[model samples]
Structures are given as structure tokens and as C-alpha cells.
Target: MPMEIRLVRIDDRLIHGQVATVWAKVTKVNRILVVSDDVAKDILRKTLLKQASPPGVIVNVITIDKMISIFNDPKFNDFKSMLLFTSPRDARRVVEGGVKLDTINIGGMSFSDGKKMITNAVAVNSEDIEDLKYLNEQGIKLEIRKVVADNKVYMMDLLKKEKMI
Candidate 1:
């Protein structure tokens, strides 16, 4: 069965103003499926995220396993949803677990210790590079674009140029 996953985006701040008002309009996605164990279990964060979504858009906070299950289920085949993951590992899990995607977007990861800052908001570590390499090997197109209007930079090429991997 084919899943109507319009966008597979890795954004730390999920369902915020830009995502709710801009990306949703550009992608035309009605549902936003946030796949993350940490966020799924956080009541306050989850509620805040839910409230951030636009009035007509449905936002679902689920774990990686739950997203895998949902992808396997036939009921969501027709749902036009954006799959949001907090990390590359989380995105890799769903893709490796039988979910299909031709493209993946990296919006933000935030700078942190032991992580190389690739873009203004995207910082990647060794594990993230490995996950990205795996996805590239699987023939998934990867790009770094903060918002819909921004010009997307091919992530793998950027990694090669920066010698991060």
C-alpha cells in the first residue's frame, strides 16, 4: 500500500508558527504526525504543540513504534500528512521499518556539544551523519531548508564540502 506522506521533515520545534501557517499551506497537508518518544510522553509539550497547529489541521503526537504501526495499517493510506521527526535516527527507524519516501527535509537541529553546525540551525553529529548516509544510500533525496521560501541545499553535498563525514 502507498502512504500519502507529503513531507518527511526533521524539525526540533514541531508544529510551531512557521509550520502551522506556512509549511502546511505550501505542502497542503491536513495532518501533522509528530513521531518522537520524548515529545509523545510530555503532556505540557504535547499540549503546546497541539495548540500550535492551525484550527483545521489535525496534529498527532506519536512514538516511533506507533508511527511504524500506523504506516503498516491500511487506514492511513489516503491521509495527506507530514511526518515530523526530531532526529535523523528517528527518521531512519520509520524508513527502515517499511515506510517509503523519496525525499526528506531537514529544517532545524540546533547547535550542541559534539555536533557540527552545518547550517544556521542544523547541527549534526557522527550518528546523524551515519543516518544521513544510510538514507542517501537508500536513494532518498535529502536537503536542508529552514522554510518553504528558502533555497534548499543538498545535505549530502554540503556534508562532503564541509568534510563533516
Candidate 2:
């Protein structure tokens, strides 16, 4: 069997309380792949994320290319993973690089300069909107929910309501 990618989520916070606790349980994934070049290079953040991992779940901070490579390798087929990306562009890159993902959860994109709030937790700039639209156009389901219990909202609908698309 191929590597089972249980969930693909985009959250700028990466691994945090909600992710390490709630998401890991909900996804039933043994591995959490933090697929980001920036975080992979930051030793402090990488160590922090590893320390923040859930009891049984293994966390790996790796670049986009490394994720693509390992994901394609047959040797890693036993991994049931939940991939975390800091941006829609990164998720798009991994998808375009040949990771077969059908849905991406927009967990949290914190308020930042030059970004407009779509929801209480999600803020997106023009570039983010573009990348999100590209993923939507590629027939990927974009869901917005901070936690598994929250009602899932469609990203495109929020974009349309905000007049972003």
C-alpha cells in the first residue's frame, strides 16, 4: 500500500496545542509531517515542535522537496500521516510536486499586516487568496475549521462572501 496521507492542513502556527492534541486524535495519524522549508531550517522551532508532539505521534519537520521524496518512497508506506503546511502556496507546491491530496483544511492563518480577516482565526493576503484559488481550481476541497468539532466551512464560499474571488 502507498503512504496514507490522512489530512493536509494549512496553519501558520504549525504544531500547537490544538494540533498536537485534537488533530492527532481525529486524524488517527501516527506521523505528523511539518512540511515547511522555513520551519525545517529553524532549529529552535523544530525542536519545540518535536517536544510539543502527542504521546504516540511522531513529528517530522522537513522541507517540501523532502516530503515529496519520502512520500513517494515505497519504504515509507507504513506511515499514516497528517501533513501541516504554513501556507497555501506550500501546499500547492507539494500537491503539484505529486503528493495526491484531495482536501486541505484551513485551520488558522493568524492576523498579519496586509492580510484581511476571513474568519476569526483566518486571515489571508492577496497572494494567499491566489494560491487558495489555484488549489480550488485544481478540484481540491478547501475546508475551514479550527478544530474537528467546528462546522466545516468551504473556503471558496468564504472567499466569495468576502469578495476575494
Candidate 3:
């Protein structure tokens, strides 16, 4: 059984305006799996996110563990799905745990005090950069593109320019 999963966008602000407006429309995805341990346990946030989703779209707030299990399961192989993660660490963990996928899109990772700004839209803390390097080392194609319209930026290019990786 083969699955049709495309464009795993990593954005901390799950189910936001950008996601609903740009990604959902551009990708034409009907199902969104919010793969995060935090949201999975928080009933309030989960309910709000589910309510915020556009009609005809199904949203599932699940943990990384659940995602790993589901990815390995033979049943979901027939489903057309889109996976969303909140952070680079979670993304790296999912891949390291054997959730085999090719490319990941870095959508909007906000800046913190210690984070080095990669682009106008993307910022990276040390841990986040390390996670990206780990994903790159694993042969996963990582690109930084805020919206469907923006030009794609490779992690290696950003890393080299910033001297992080």
C-alpha cells in the first residue's frame, strides 16, 4: 500500500492564517495531522485548532509517538495525508524514529532572543539548527520557504552563510 503525503510544513503556529490561507489552498490538502506531543495532551488547544480548520478538512492532534506508530502501520498507507510539526526537534525525532519521508518544508520558525535570524521569516536557535543538520545528515531534503509563492532556501546555504552547521 502506498500513501500520498506531500509537503510536511514545520510551523509552530499550527492552523494559523498563513497555513489555512496559503498552504492548504496551494497543496489542496483535505487532511491535516498536527503531530505534536504538546497539542495532543492539551485538550483546550486541540479543540480550538480542530474548530479553526476549514470545513471539509479533517484535523487530528496527535503525539510524536502516535505519528511514528501510524507511519509504520499498514492501514494508513492508502490515505492522502499532510503532516505538520511545531519544531525542528520534533521533525528530526519523527524522521530518526523511522518515519521515512523525503523532503520537509520550513514554514515559519519565529525568532527568540538567542536565535540567529536566517531569513526575514525564519529564525534558528542552536538546538533548531542542530536538528536541521541532523535531518540534512539523514539525507532529508530541507527547504526554507515561507509561502507557496516565495523562493525556496536550502538549509545548507543558510547554514554556510550563518556559520551554524
Candidate 4:
């Protein structure tokens, strides 16, 4: 079977209200893979996050290490999985570790000190900007978009303006 994955969105708040309410329904995704080392280590947190997901959706919280192991396995490619990551560092780690994917959709990365605000909903620090540029150089599409309906913001454009890339 040809497996399909949609909306590889990077949001700090993983599997939350917006994800469950908007992105999940819009993408018609059946599986959600949250790639986070923190969640993977904590059994209680993983259980809570799993419970937060809607009834029909199969949610899996896996560490970067575990994700790499699974991604290397051909059998893992059989399922339609939407990959979610918390930060650009994690995303870069996954890519650097050889997790292949075409595009990465950026959603809500909140504003923090030392991070330049991309938009009201999105922000980027020097590290994240560099990561985005690196991903772009790797021929991966880096799009900063809030939702399916929002306009696509290219990482290259953001880099040029911010001079971070």
C-alpha cells in the first residue's frame, strides 16, 4: 500500500487543542508521531498526551533515537504517519540522524527572549534560523505556515530578511 503522511508541523505544544481540532481534521490523518526525547522518557507524560488525542487517531510518542531506528526499518514505512517535533533542534537532529522527508511545516513557535518574531504566531532564534537554512540547503522544503489555509512563508525569505541564514 502507498502510505501518505501530511502536515509535518513543528509546534512546541504537541498534540494540543489546535492540533486535535484543526490540523488532524484538515489533513485526515490517522496516525500522529510525536518525536520528542522528553516525552519518550516520561511514561506518565506519554500516557497523558496519548489520551489527549482524539478517539480514532493513533498517537505514538517516540524519542529521536527510537524514531531513527524505526525510520531505518522498511516495515515502518507501511503506515501513514504525521511527524511532529517540538523545536528546530529536534527537527534538525532527526534530519541529521537520517530521517528523510520532503517538507516541514512550521506552525506555532512562541516568542521568547533572543528569538526574533516571525509573526504573531511564530518566532525564530539564531539557532532555529540556521537549522532552517541547513534544511533548505539539504533540498528539504522549509515552509513556515500556521495552518493549511495560511500562506506559505519560505525559510529562505525569512533568512534573507533576518540575516540569520
Candidate 5:
């Protein structure tokens, strides 16, 4: 069962304005699946995320492992969805778990400890660089763009320029 995962994004603020309002309209995916262990366990955060969803679009905040399991569950594969991850490592894990995705959008990763600022609104830690490099080496396309209005900047190309990967 090829899950209709229209887009994969790594946004720390899972279902924020750009995703809730802009990208959702751009991708036209009816469902939003936020796959993150931390968010899935926080009831308050999960509720807030659901509330932010655009009308007519359903949102599900689920654990990373559960998300991987859903691929085999026919009931979960019925709708087209935009997949969200909080980190590049998790995104890599899901693809490794067998979900089909050729391109990933680097939406926004907030600067935190161990993270190096790559581009404005985008940052990468050592693990993030490693995982993203792995995805690129495995033939996945990576783009860092905040919204539809911004130009699509292929992240791997920048990484090469920086000698990070």
C-alpha cells in the first residue's frame, strides 16, 4: 500500500501558520499527520495542533513508531496526507521504515543547542547533517524553503558548498 504522502516536512513547530495556512493549500492534502514522539505524548500540544488545522483538513499527532506501523494498516492509507516530522533523524527513520518519498521540504528547524545556523530560518546539528546527507546519498531530494513564495533552495547543494557532508 503506497501511502499518499504528498509532502514530507521537518518543522519544529509542527502545524504553524505556514503549514496550517500556506503549505496545506499549496499541497492540497486533505489530512495532516504530525509524526513526533514528543508531540504525541503531550496532550495539550496535540490539542493545540489540531485546533490550528485549516478547516476541512484533519490532523493526527502520532508517535513515530505508530506512524510507521500505520503504513501496513489499510484504514490509515485511505487519504492523501502531508507528513510532518520534528527532526531530520525522524524523517530518515520513516523513509527507512518503507514509506515512499522522493523529496523532503525543510520547513523550519529552530536554532537550539548543538545546532549550527545554516540559513535564516533553517539550522542543522551534527545528527541532522548526517541524516540529511544519508537521505541525499540514498537519492532523496532535499529543499529548504519557508513557503510557496520563497524559491526552492536544494539543501544538499548548500551542504556541499559548506563542506558539511
Candidate 6:
């Protein structure tokens, strides 16, 4: 089926309990691909993420370019992967790189310097807003939810409420 992308989630804290247990079960993904340049470069972090994954599910940490490469390769068609990104900017880059994404789940973005809180679990800076806006412009549905059981909140609605859009 050409490597089904079960879900594309943006969570600063990747591969957490909710992701490992809930999302993994809901999506029925055999592989969890963490596409982050920083995490892929950090050996300790890479190993930790792998260790954090749920049993029976393989986890791979790789750069965005590598993801695009394997995604386009025929040999990788056997995987049903759930892609994890740390930021909307990285997700946007992958989208621009020609990976078709219909939707992106904004799992969590903790409060950081110069960022405004949109939701308790989500915060955004000007750069984040721009990247998110770009993704929205590409006709991708952006939703915010900490877990599968949580009600889906449309990201643009929150942005509009915050007057960021």
C-alpha cells in the first residue's frame, strides 16, 4: 500500500506514554518514525526514544531528508508508520519536499521563550505561527489534541481566537 502514513504528529516530547500506548494502538502502526534532525544526531536521545517506544513497534530516528528518501523508495512500502516531528517548521519542510500529508496533529508544544500559549498543551512563537499558517495554506488540516480520547481542536480556530492569524 506504499507505506501507509497512519498519522503525522508534532509533539516536542516525542514518544511519550500517550504516544507509545494510545496513539500506537489507535493507529495500528508497526513503526514510529521520529523525523527530527536534532534527535537523529544525538545518539543518547535516539537510543532513549527507541527505548521509550511500545513493545512490538520498531522506532527509527532519522533526518527529514532521509524520511523523504525512504518514503519514496519502493522497498519501504511494507511499513505502516506514524511520523513524529518536533516542530511545524520541520513538518512544513517535509511537505514541501513532496511528502503528501492530509493532516497534522499538534500534540504538544510547551511554553518557551517568546512563545504565546494557545492551549495548555500548545504554545507558539512568530516562527511557529508562520510555519503553521503555511501548512494551513497548503490545505492540510491542523488539529490539537494531547491524546486520542481528547476532543480534536482545530489549530486555525485557536490561532484565530488568539488573534495570531
Q: Pick the candidate with the highest lDDT.
A: 6
The C-alpha RMSD of each candidate to the native structure, in angstroms, is 1.1, 0.9, 1.5, 2.0, 1.2, 0.8
Write one digit per residue (lDDT tens) for candidate 6, span 36-100: 99999999999999999898899999999998888878888878999999999999999888888
lDDT of 4 by residue, 62-102 (tens): 99988777876767666567889988888888889887778
Off by over 4 Å in 6: none
As a TM-score, model 3 comes out at: 0.92
1-165, model 2: which lDDT tens digit per residue? 568999899999998889999989988999999999999999999999999999899999999999888877899898989999999999999888888888999999989899999899999999999999889988999999999899999999989988888
By the TM-score metric, which is better: model 1 or model 5?
1
Q: Candidate 5 lDDT, tens digit per residue, 1-165?
A: 756888889889888888988889888999999998889999999999999999889999988788788877789767789999999999888878876678999989999888888899888878899899888877999999888899999998888887887
Q: Give me the candidate number with maximum TM-score.
A: 6
Where does candidate 1 clash, by residue pair? none
Cα distance off (Å), candidate 6, residue 30: 0.4
Residue 70 of candidate 6: its Cα lDDT? 81
Q: How many residue pairs clash in each candidate?
A: 0, 0, 0, 0, 0, 0
lDDT of 5 at 50: 92
In model 3, where is the ten-residue run with the lowest total lDDT?
1-10
The C-alpha local distance difference test score for the whole of candidate 1 amounts to 0.89
- On TM-score, the stronger of 2 and 5 is 2
For 11-127, candidate 1 gives per-residue lDDT tens digits of 898777788888898889889999999999999999988888876788989998888888857888777899898999999988888788889999999788999888888999999
Clashing pairs in 6: none
Worst 10 residues of 6 by lDDT: 67-76
Local accuracy of candidate 3 as per-residue lDDT tens digits, 1-165:
445677697988888877776787777777788999989999999999998786677888999988888885777775567788989999888888888778899888888899878888788888998898888888889998877888888977888988886
Supply the global lDDT for candidate 6: 0.93
